[model samples]
Target chain A: MFAEGPSVFSRFIVCLVLSFLLIVIDQRQQRLESVRATLAVVLYPIHLVVDFPTTLVRATAEKFSSRRELRAANERLRAENLELRFRMQRYQTLERENERLRALLDTSVMVGQKVLAGELLAVETTPSAHEIIINQGVRSGVFPGQPILDAEGIMGQTVHVNPFSSTAMLITDPRHALSVAVNRSGVRAIAVGTGSMAQLDLNFIPNNADIAEGDLVVSSGMDGVFPAGYPVGVIEVIEFEPTAPFARIKLRPHADLAHAREVLFVWPQTPEQDTPAAVPATEAPAP
Target chain B: MSLRNLRGTLLIGLSILIAFALTVLPLPAWAQAWRPAWVALVLMYWSMAVPERVGVITAWFIGVLLDVLVGTTLGQHALGLAVIACLTVIYHKRLRVFSQLQQGSICAGMLLLYVTLLRIVDRFAGVPVPSVSYLTVVTSALLWPWLFIILRDVRRKGGVR
Candidate 1:
């Protein structure tokens, strides 16, 4: 018979046996970080080579765009710039008035968190998992569990931290659940991703919950990672099954996760360098 | 090993690097939903086209790397990928005879198997069963043919055998 000998089957069986041993060892969280780090270093050069082709095509396309298209884009931008400047003037006045009002009340406003920027390196496109790798890593002052955000809104959280790179779990991943609240009513619920990037589901809310299809869900700041009131998603549907107690609510994330090339890592607390001018000065005391 | 064998090993290593790079590409949101399983596709290609060169151990090692990169349960992908590699080798002969389309279809099935196996492991780790749309095996299966042709062409032109 063609399959008479131990053949490829026997070899495969042996391989499987070896793999099981490796899996067992790996699962116990053995000291493999050094090996992984070294491998990543070796891999860095190869990554550059593979990424070259795509970058080349993108650059060439940008270079060759027609001047007509560029002019049209510039005209649209100028119009938008004028509108934004008008709004900014109103915002500046409101901000100054609010700050003065706050001073009178002895209340302090939260300083904007300083952001460390990172570029996207890779995204896990496989259906089995949802994750993205950022160019920044632990060495770049990144930490596991830190929240990642783009200009639009919250994207995900850092799950794995290596010396050279960190992997961020996307909000669309099945394992991801954000504690969010309806922007209008402040009613809280958990929003879980449905695998597909376009949608998510809100849970732990009653059937009669005052949530509608257009309602916005923002971070409640209960998780201690994302700051409160950041946009998360807008409810798309609220299906109330008569028999089921919980409302089946679907949502669309406001963040442009797919096209976002750069992101900001939000540490739970401000870094020592970004702490208030008084906090650091108080510690040194003219030493 | 002979120089020829060493060259083959180098190609395999380089291919893994390529696979890792593909995993890191910046895909648009809509495209991400349809993105091919590059790591599994490339690993399956190498493991089949060169069984003597790449095997289940190699698959498991890469699987662990993916687990780290994807940030899932530690051994989850290692087990799934290793098993898929074993299956690929066990059926390599029949696979070799099949047309590119058929081979890709099978690869897609194997990728689906990989995801399913991963979910089972994730469930055991106390992660709730994800959304109902977690079954994305068919899309990967459909992508199998295209991936197979592209990678096979690379191997053939690179003179891997």
Candidate 2:
């Protein structure tokens, strides 16, 4: 027990006002970013501590994995690698032909986009919150609104960046909306997050539109956030109402959206790279 | 500060760190929202036990750190936690004399208040927090008694007072 202080109420009131000021300041400006980054610096070690048990479990599991499992995995990877290499040859020829055609048409050709690998940190804020923290941050050239993807498909974009890490809001967040086009019909639709890991909704599609239940939806890149041609999800369900203006369309995302450990941060094309090329340079030897 | 007081502060700081660890602990998706407001619980316990040392200002600071950790706007948790600490301190005297069930009820009320403030701030920030996000209040109230006992034992063993 401690002595009662007369300053308790005063201290509490001051704290309340200060907190309100902080909230308003944070909402309006970037002034508090340094403060947040500094606090994140302090909290990073705690993240490591919280992440330890999972790391330990994964390490032990890796250590004791049977040789047969390893051999099977290696064999499967070898076959997959060969298959990819086989397809890549055809892709290269098509790319060269497309470039030649584009050169004739005076259309700008975009080069390769760079991707950085990052691992999800151990702690999640809450189930209700769709934000996730990853190990990449300002130090790794991570920026706010940078696109994030898993190996399978587009995940989401970064919302906040600290000195050592960043926070990303997943595509399943209720506030998230993505512009997507149906692969089968090429009819564009807006996919809105339903705040669930299992589903998203194409909220504005007309009942009589060209969309189908099984059509694969890919990012149209109209939003300028996600890259073009990345698979977003597959249309899972469609319900039509004669009186209603729009059909209720559901989607199952291509990315796991849950339990994604490794993510790729894509660096989108810069203005210089996207600008139409000058006269053709010397061509490299054929692969 | 005296050496004993320094040690006591360090002990309290260690418990806060542990609470932070629990607050962000990775649970299954179904169980994630049920994490019993660990940081808030620890802040409540300390402010109730030693109001002079861990009161409104400390709670607010911890809230700021938690916001950075959890990736919310700054001061969302700060205002909620400051109010919680304020309530605990205001009623600590009568609360200590009450039965455990009665104290638990008061804690539930405080948890509700904190969650309401959190939701208000969240809504103001345009986050689409659902009505069901109050699950933490239900879970925090249920776990308060056990957490109280554990922290009390730690305080006594460490000679914090």
Candidate 3:
């Protein structure tokens, strides 16, 4: 026995205007961010509930793993740990030497960054956006613009942070770009995401630049977002178009963007606060 | 109010929740492009079935929820779904009487409109629109018949007049 107060068309127009206002507010101003964040807290439980089934399946699979498989995995991990320890020893010596050299040159020593490990909760379901939600968020000291890395290299940056989770835009997202340098020749360039998971495009590199097909690309840290010297990607293709002024260079990202389950949130060292004083007396003579 | 009506509303709410979960379920890389717009389909179903109960305002609210869940620009889905709800309310009688196949075609058209609107919003927001996203409309349209039948059964069993 219920009839409408307003006609469907009138309601549609009202709602349409309201939605337009929302879109404009969300896009042009950051005013809606607090609302979104508050709503995200409410939405988090739904995510956890939706993910419960997958977590159950994984747990069951782990429970059913064979003894032989477990032993083999343990052995492999132990060997890997030994190898990492050996490499770490060499790295420590090199780090000390580099510090001494920096002191001699009257520059600050590189500050080590702190990292928070985060597990990927979900990948964005939209085919257009390459983003992932990680379990670390504002409560975990994650902030927007924090650089995310996998074991291999820089993966992306956090775009939004809720209380318990943050959304990270992958380096392969078309809107994302980072300043990078050729690890071999130190030629600076900007690598932009191509909207494809497999490739990133280097923008405006001259054809004469000493970029090889397999040169490593590392973050230049010029943008002040990503820390310096982390591997970003590797050059996969370099096409010289006779008509085009710039070379078309594509890169395969070093981090496994599609399949990475865990990522590192880097707390970059603030230069002014963390930089070691440039004292000449601290310099040790090179052997 | 009445227990029967409450049951009907609960059924509708449950169906929407299931649809949202399906929308977020992980698909293999190759099949990701073909994901059906589960939430849109559910919204269309309810709006068509019970315009008074599930109208443009309800569609707008659900659309915003979907937007948050999918992490898209806010109100993008609200705009699309509001239009769809309006159209469905206007043509609910005709759409109900049409053959299943004809209704499926109409569903495809609505989904295409939604996709196109979303793509335009994405362009303005500076997110890259993937060509494969168009495939979702086709997949959603193709799945309409089964979704329609299942939802209709639930409506009938719940006595949701």
Candidate 4:
């Protein structure tokens, strides 16, 4: 083969230098986000092509289900709906009381929270990074740092949002950590992912902390990323040593992090940022 | 360019698209790590077969596409695939003379290097890429000989050269 225009060695060196610069830019947070978003739009077709087969099989399976299977599913949903309605009734009264108490305290009352439902894209965005893509993107108002959830509880937060899709890092990713409080005792601690979907490690929890095995863990809302009171995990194990400064506490996350097919993108900050303050100011001017 | 050359180029693009498609198709839970790294294997074949066309630039751009596909940092795959392409170019003459088994062994080494480079870059980027581990190395190596045969047959039949 004849030597090409630039020669292989020169081209290789150029590409290496260029890519090294790109990785540096990409690693510094959102500096490369706009470029990624543009490139992601071009690559969107690749994702669609890759996703076709999985969605097709899923759709076909749902369509070809037997009447008995459909009936069983319908029955289960109906029973679940009834149970939810009972809980809804109780929550409605609690919500009214919460507003009255807030009015007495001269604090802004909590409004109904908003969430956007999204299906998990079939692509494993980053297998090692514990990143998952969702079909919702910037077009649907999805934004970075939005908390993600499943039916059970807090899952992760969106790290990058493209035009057609968004990538979320799961809470179990080693790069991620969350602030959580023990629901029973309100002890605050940092929960760091253990690189396993099934477990998270709580840091700086003293041996004498009020937490016990089976204690419920919920987000503390202190970090401003995840809202307070969402179920995060249940403590499964705690080991203490006499010489150690902190106990080793293991938690099993409530969200089915590994298997969830649907996720909810929550608007926790939107409430305070857009609703209560603006509503009163606009209404008072009319009066 | 002649019709044959154009068709050959199309075939290269098509094969890669198919590899990308295979990547997103869900595997059974236990078989996730066992699935061969399709893109790596495809690039290994192409860089060796047509080093003139699929050189470091092509490999780097394809790596960029993969980065977007998998949501990694922009240049992680680019750097890894570039290394693979560069090595293949430097060794293409000797590689052509080698038997299938020998070629596959070298391809396995390249694949392992590509994966390891990715993990190292991922570590630098603050993403810990454990769990999948080096299992892909074994699977990609196992798939190498068969993939080489199929691609070689297709290239010859289609007059890709």
Ranking by DockQ, best first? Answer: 2, 4, 3, 1
Output the lDDT of residue B124, model 4: 81
> Candidate 2 residues A147-231, lDDT tens each?
8999989898887788889889888887777778998888888877777888988877888899777899998776777777789
- Which 10-residue window in model 4 chain B sums to the lowest lDDT? B125-134
Error of 3 at B46 (Å): 0.7
lDDT (0-100) at residue A180 of candidate 3? 90
Q: Looking at candidate 2, what is the lDDT of residue A197?
A: 86
Model 2 accuracy (lDDT, Cα):
0.84
Off by over 4 Å in 4: A1-6, A106-108, A271-287, B130-132
Give the TM-score of each candidate.
0.69, 0.92, 0.91, 0.91
- Clash-forming residue pairs, model 3: none
Quality of candidate 4's docking, in CAPRI categories?
medium
lDDT of candidate 1 over B39-129, digit per residue (tens)? 7777888878877667777787787777555455556667777778878877888998998778767876787777777767655555544
RMSD of 4: 6.2
Off by over 4 Å in 2: A1-6, A275-287, B130-132
Q: What is the per-residue lDDT of model 1 for residues A47-134, given as tens digits with 9 covering 90 to 100?
A: 4565567667877988999999889999999999999999999978887888789789876554456678998763442434567777
Tens-digit lDDT track of model 3 for A162-208: 99888888888777888899999999988888778999989879888
Instruction: For model 2, name the residue pairs that clash.
Output: none
Q: What are the per-residue Cα lDDT tens digits for candidate 4 across A116-202? A: 999987776555567788889999999887889999999999887999898888888777887889999999998888768899888
